[model samples]
Target: MIKVKRVYDAPESDDGVRILIDRLWPRGVKKDLVDIWMKDIAPSDELRKWFNHEPEKWEEFKHKYMEELRSNPKVKVLIEVIRRSENVTFLYATKSPYNNAVVLKEYIESLLTK
Candidate 1:
């Protein structure tokens, strides 16, 4: 199974092979703070700026983000890794708790569950 965690949260054992999915290094976080920084798995700069976490644009954003993920082998590889791994956590810095990774996690889990 895959898990989601915030960077500020203390690392835990269950979050096996923690992967930081943010395109940019989280503000104020040390490079050594997290393991396996999978920056390539994150959305592109263009996509990140486009979404900007606007509630009004979330629905549209989700659609486009998922499409981008599908087209990008880097993002897809992360999902593939999680599907094959016993336990992996997607660590993101967003405070919303409803960022693209939330939806992306669900999509990854669904693929694994199948």
Candidate 2:
């Protein structure tokens, strides 16, 4: 199973391998909060700045982000990690529920289904 969680949330035992997926370390968050920090798997700086978490731009952001995932070699590394784990959690610092981790979870699920 895959889970998406905010970095600020209290850690749970069922979270499994918690991986932070943000390009930058979130302020006030300690390094020990996550099991792994996969910053490279996050969106590129260009795309992240473009979207800016605007609800209206979500569709376009998702499309461009999917393109990035398709070409990113780091995705294979994430996949390998997921395959080895019974459960995995993606951690992000965004306040919005519709953040990069949500998109990444959806993208990874699609890849796993194939």
- The regions of model 1 sitting more than 4 angstroms off are none
Every candidate's lDDT = 0.78, 0.95
Cα lDDT, model 1, residue 21: 83
- Report how far residue 36 has shifted in candidate 2, in Å: 0.6
How good is model 1 by TM-score? 0.86
lDDT digits (tens) for residues 1-114 of candidate 2: 999999999999899999999999999998898899999999999999999999999999999999999999999999999999999999999898768999999999999999
Model 2 has a clash total of: 0
- Model 2: how far residue 77 lies from native, Å: 0.3
Q: Backbone clashes per model, in order?
A: 0, 0
- Candidate 1 local distance difference test against the native: 0.78
lDDT of 2: 0.95
The top-ranked prediction according to TM-score is 2
